[model samples]
Target: MTFTGVVPKRRLGPGGPEVPVFALGSWNTWDRMAPPERRALMGRAVEVGAAFFDVAYYNMGPHAEASRTDLLFGETLRELGLARTDYQLCGKLWLWEYPEAGFAEQMRVSLDRIGAGRGGPESFETVVVGDFMGEIDIAQVVRDVQAEIDRGSFASWGVNNWPAEALQLALDTAAAERLTPPSFAQLKYGLVRRSMAEGEFYGGWCADGTLALQASDSFEGGILVGKLAPARKIGADVGGIRERIVAAYPEVERVATDFGATPAQLGLAFCLANPATANVLFGASRVAQLDDNLGAIGVLERVGPDAIRAATAGLWLDRDVRADGVWAP
Candidate 1:
């Protein structure tokens, strides 16, 4: 289906930039696929208006030394001859250490790799602190991010994989200091894992319109697609989160079948059905997968919210499935 005119747009936050509701995420696929193949996929997405892209600095696969996805994105955009304004690009600086001295350098490296030209912060629409795993020095990180924004690296900033309380703290700190507060929060939110969606941070954001939630891992690492592991085993051996999600596959499939949709379609639809979901960031390893996910945009209206919730009623584990959480491998 052509998304040129049908896909919807939502503001990044209350007053943030408006982005397409359905955005493409580059994780294991962009660097793994050949340049031309990945280029074709990006082209297809852009042509269909699902061009808002989510990329990170850490996902170049196991063998890579540095990020290749950013470079590949630049190559594809250049090959397609798309102008800077044609699409929106979001990048994440992955830092595990409390204070990485090379924050600005890392931003420069990613920006240069993308080769989108030096229009200051115009090179990136949004950049985020990617997946901080340990105790974070809130004020220090906020100051560092603000310096980058002052230096014109990105227009806005957000956080990924941080606890809901921590996210709220950062937001509160930003308000107290009168600095640029995080405009978004990207965490694992889907039909199978409803902990974050049900948490205080999400609730506060919804109430005050302070932070936008970017829902990731909507497929529960593919278990929500109804593609069970060999022998139909559902446990840590398959995937920590998969085990939790696999248990609900039968019911998810039945509901999807009733609506003439595949389990994958229903999975994506479930993410979109969330009113708090600003964007559902998903990864695709193939052109077919990308196209299939794009079809989810049309499911929201057809299936409606009640049916989507009914279809996924018993799926929520009431536990956070984020990496290193109770479901981590």
Candidate 2:
């Protein structure tokens, strides 16, 4: 009931300028539905103050054969009467799908789906391209991105899930080639997941002027939502990764109790607490879920430093040693 005016905004990079704090991510919503449903969700997101949409070409599916999440995302935006300039668009090019092209074709298809053409303001304000498995040809990828920028395809470029060393390599390579460097790094960061933000997994980018967009900040399939109680086996639909998370963080139950808030809200608020995080991305299966998550924005505004520290101290990992054991360190 607090109804905070709106979430704050911050620049994507040192010079890229500002965007809303709580961007609505469309990772799952797009691939699973038709264009009309996607458009309706986007409209509702805009109405509730989430003006940024995070998307990606690979979000379509493993191979081009499985889905078309990205295409549907672009179609939704166009149908909703939302101009390219009206919202901050962030898309990703998964190079693994076509390492031969080195992410160029991925970017083109992404732009085309988003309606960014030769004469228009680039549909995607920023494009993130990188590997999920931690191996990348940073130099080649950087060069490919610069070519796109030169051709007016992208306003800016970024890296996703890349470690700090690789990020620095990309930046250095771009500087050497007189090309643009990445302005953002999208990684998984949240109250429950601190490896990236704390520089344990990937060195922190915020200190060097690169913005951090925290995804899976809700820990995928709503594990942080407190839906699975009393240590039961997680549903198959929740996916193997999420089941492992629930099995790992058995202590999450205690943390949820201490916060006097839902696990979902606490997880999101944790990500927002970090000044380094430019925005937190979350998805919803329905409008009701979206509204519930948006309420966390107000919860975030009211939370103080002490609360954040307490939440951090109370992480479920501390109580459940098996948590880290489940995943590769």
Candidate 3:
């Protein structure tokens, strides 16, 4: 995780940009910090090479509501006099309302808010198109994303929580058209979840070096860290295994103690252990929490990926998120 202080960096894939293994999410950030604390978060992130951020508009998906997290993030960057190069942003587009919302409209909305604070980049470094709804036109989605990339909106793009077939079709379409393919796939991967990313579909692509894996929801929206009944909205229970996930937390705690680490560290380390994971996406509202999450890097080093995987194998929640074809397909 570190030679000294810097977090490690790896390519998103062969064609994508290199980024740090720890990317922060923008879910609960709007209320967490005052001005100085936010400034300190940015500074410490840069200091530890965790400047990559996943800031998405919550205009769609479960518990959909308006959020100004991205605006505040951009404003903080401007306040600190940080250049665009000082940090990386992974913008997101939603498939929850595809074709109608489209990629262009969403990008326009996201950039306007993020840039409204000034001194922020006009575009994201990379983007993740996520939240699979019913089946949609894969060609149109890929084309729209590629068009955005061509327009310098973002350098590379990835699919989030998409069906394996959709990922395949997107790649095939990109290859056939000679357009840029999605360089990565962000999936729900961690100690409690393994099927999507580690299953045959994505693992093969990662093994062939065709796509990188961005691990998300590894903490199950802080539930893995003993926030058993968090007041804030966590991601929808895509697996329909909330009870199982909650029950497994005890094992997580036990395993983390055995490994001489916090439950948060063990959960994160489990995600990092996977060879395909380009980075682990997490949310840390406070700088102290961010620093605490960083300890997973050390835990990974101490425990080794294999031992960690084996120890937590019983906690794995393997479910095809796209099975029902109602919410996702």
**Which candidate comes out best when scored by TM-score?**
3
lDDT of each: 0.69, 0.61, 0.82
Question: Model 3, range 1-329, lDDT digits (tens) per residue?
Answer: 33247899888876888999999888777446788888888788988889999997786866377777877887887888887788898999998888888788898888888774355678888998877768799988989998899888899998887777887888999999988898998877788777767667787887788989899888888889998887877776776887888888889999999999989899888888877789988888777788888899899998899999899888877564443212332
Of 1 and 3, the candidate ahead on lDDT is 3
- Please give each candidate's TM-score: 0.86, 0.80, 0.93
Error of 1 at 261 (Å): 1.3
How many clashes in each structure? Answer: 0, 0, 0
Please say which candidate is ahead in TM-score: 1 or 2: 1
State the lDDT of candidate 1 residue by residue for 1-329, as single tens digits: 63445457777775456887777776654776787788788877777777898865553222145657666767777777777677888877765644653578767767777773633224567876855556667777787888888887777887776666666677788889977888877767777776665565564675477777777777765677865663321223213455556677888888888887777778778877777777888777667887777777677678798888886777877564343222232
Better candidate by TM-score, 2 or 3: 3
Model 1 lDDT vs. the true structure? Answer: 0.69
Worst-scoring 10-residue span by lDDT in model 2? 320-329
Q: How many backbone clashes does candidate 1 have?
A: 0
